[model samples]
Each structure stands twice: as structure tokens, then as C-alpha cells.
Target: MKVEMILKELEALGSERTKKSYLQQGAHEPLFGVATGAMKPIAKKVKGNQAVAEELYATGNYDAMYLAGMIADVKAMTEADFDRWMEGAYFYMISDFIVAVSLAETEFAMEVSDRWILDGRELYGSAGYSCYCWLLGNRKDEEFDQDKLSEMLDLVKKTIHTSEDRVKYAMNLFVVTIGVSYLPLHEKAVEVAHAIGMIEISDGKGKHNLPVASVEIQKAVQKDRLGFKRRNVRC
Candidate 1:
């Protein structure tokens, strides 16, 4: 389907209750508030439409931007395209999930993650951490870079507390991702999680209570789910 038709459908599907929930999750206005399940059929119809995805993303409507991620051809997207997506990311959902997941599917995953983590911008840094986490979760053990992952753990140990609130949250999730999916780094991730202790984040709506990495890792271990690779990270 065309971008115009998709936009019209999204507008028709918009929900005020869902929009309020999205607001709590950091979404801005000009949104359709379409649910993920509702967007899937549209995504299937528009699959592989890079041009149309770009047009949707450019609209800056929360729903369309999300749909852009769903329909984008990540392999065909240029580094410049990814950079624009990152810059246009307006909140955690768009940055950490949409942009980061798309970037992870590209060859630029490592390079982008490294650059974005050091950017110090909240959403960018969160996207960076999230990209790395998705990489670790999806890539096999043979393809893993142990040394670089170790260095990232050290970086988290040093800077997590002082990082932006959302970055800290992403960093905490990173540790959990390493512990649960990268067997070689599991112990080190637990150590870092213990060293870092509890993490706190807020979106200005309410008190944000994030998961403890060590505890989450332990639960995964108990369930014999360690080193389990996800088929894909993109939603």
C-alpha cells in the first residue's frame, strides 16, 4: 500500500486511550496510537518498501515512524539514512526500539553502537546500548567479540551511575543482555551488575523501577535459558 493510504488507515485506527498510554511511555503528539498487533498486517503489506518507509518516517507521526521501522529494508538503508533516523528519534520507543533495532540489522551495527554510546545524548546513548544488547542477543557465540564486550562492561561499570537516566536504564538492560545471552561474559556481567547495584530512572510520569541485572540473569540461568539467541530483535 502507498504511504498516503497507510497514513489514512493509521488515523482511522487511532485511539485516545492508547495515546495516553503512549504518552506515559514518552511518545509525543501527531500520533495514531495504533497498537503493535494492529500495525503488523500493514507492515506485512508494505514489507520491503524502503521508499515508502522513508516517507512515513519523515512524517514524524509516532505511528508512522514506528511503521517505518517495521517496513524498512535495513540491509538497503545507507549509513546516512540510519543517522537521519537516529537524529529524528523523538523518544525512547523510537530511539531504543525502532532506530536501534534497524541499525542492528545493518553492517553498521558495531560502528554505530560505538559512536552512539560515546555521544552522551540520552536517546543516542540509549540507542547505542540497546543496539549492542540486540546484537549480543541475536548473534552467535562464534561471531561474538569478547574483548569489546568486556570493554563495554567496564565502561558501564565506570559511567552508568553518572549517565543520563534513560542511558542508565539501557545500560542496566545491556548488562542483563550480556549475562543472559553471552555465556562467556555471564560471570563478568553479574559482577558488574553487583558493583553497580540498583539503578533508578524516571520519565516524569511516575517513579521508574527498572530490573536488576544480576537478579534477572539469575532467573534466566534457573530457567536454563542462558546463551539462548533471539531469532530477531526488530519489532
Candidate 2:
């Protein structure tokens, strides 16, 4: 309830860097997307009588933990102290959320996206796409981009002509939907698909599968990640 107390505890936790060396070195069996594992032991190493342990696990991981710290004195939190827990996250732990999205958990994807924007800022691109893809499972929906898959395809074609790595990756995942649905923006997607080399020329029956190559998608994503390098622009 007191800002002074919260600040003191946060300083204590932040000062425990030595105790978290193994975590930084990543030498232990990593619990990928986990910060709680890292925080718990560090909390125990605290010298004072601080209830660091309670704050460390108050929520679950960093996001919740930070929230708990801000909302209440974790070392002395009470049920009545549970104010609006999410007071705009101070520190973020996004690894676990990333893993969850890879599993195609739409609920998780959407939820994470929402939280990232509202609490953590816009550091959730991979997860946002995961949510979009999950919602557009099998690539059959035409609602994406105003149903203008074709427009995207066209852009892809142009990108291919220029060998633009970014367009190539995004477009490949844009196509591969063969369902009998009409995406009003199919033209847009078509341009995009062309740019990425996702042109699956069917046998004039619309009965064949919308073939998608995992390798191509992987390469695209890899490129997308690398595009974040200091030499490139932000995604």
C-alpha cells in the first residue's frame, strides 16, 4: 500500500545479481520461458527478513510477480492488499508466452497479445502472429486483411522480383488456403503470395490441397527475427 515500501523491496531484489549468476549464464537446466524459477532461489538468498519468497511467487512469473510487488508488499501482502494487480507491468517475462503461442493456443495467443499491449508494451510480435494464424487455422478464412489475400499475393510477387526477404516470408504463410471461400482482399494476398513464392498452381478444379512448406515458413520467420538486427529496421 505504500510506495516507499515497494521501492525498498524492489531495490533489494534487484541487488541480488550475484545470486542470479547461474540464471544469466543459463548453465542450469533451463525452464524456458520461466523467470519464477530464477526468482525463487534468488529470493531465498536475501539476507534481511524480507518475505521475498511471497512476492516472488505471488502471481506466477515476472509479469504477475511485478504486479504483486506493485500492488502489495509481497513480503507482507494480504488478501485485502489485492488492488488492481496490473499496474502497468514494470518488467516483462515473455518466453513462456512465446512457447504457448507455438502450440496454437488461440486463447493464450489472444490473451498474451492483449496483455502485451496493455501492460507490457508492443514486444509481442511473434505471439501476435501466432494468435492471427491460430484464428486463421488451415488458412481458409478470408477475413484477414479485409479478405484480400490476393492483394497480399501480388505484393509477394513483387517482393520476389526484388528478392525482399521480409515479404517472401510473410507471403508464404499468407497462402495455402483452398477452401471455397471468398476473401474480398484476395487480390492483396495474391500479390503477397507471389512475392514469397507461395504460388500453388492448382489443377483447375480447386480440389487440391493448399500446400504449405514448413521449411519455407521457418526461413521466413528466421529472416523476420534477424530483421530486428541493428542494421535493419524494426518490425
Candidate closest to the true structure, highest TM-score: 1
How well is each residue in 1-235 modelled by candidate 2, as lDDT tens digits? 2323433444455423432642453222212232333334433434232244244434344423432332222334332222222222221132212221222322243444334323322223323332344345423343344433344344345543333222222234434221112244434443344345433433334434233433333444455531111221100
Candidate 1: segments with Cα more than 4 A from true spot: none
* Range of the 10 consecutive residues with the lowest summed lDDT in candidate 1: 200-209
- What would the per-residue lDDT of candidate 1 be over residues 53-171, giving only the tens digit for each residue? 99999999999999999989998898888889998998999998899998989887889888988887899999999998889899887676899899999999999888889899999
All candidates' lDDT scores? 0.90, 0.33
Error of 1 at 190 (Å): 0.9
Q: What is the TM-score of each candidate against the true structure?
A: 0.97, 0.28
Model 2's TM-score against the true structure:
0.28
Superposed on all Cα atoms, model 2 deviates from the true structure by an RMSD in Å of: 15.5
- lDDT score, residue 46, model 1? 89
**How far out, in Å, is residue 131 in model 2?**
1.4
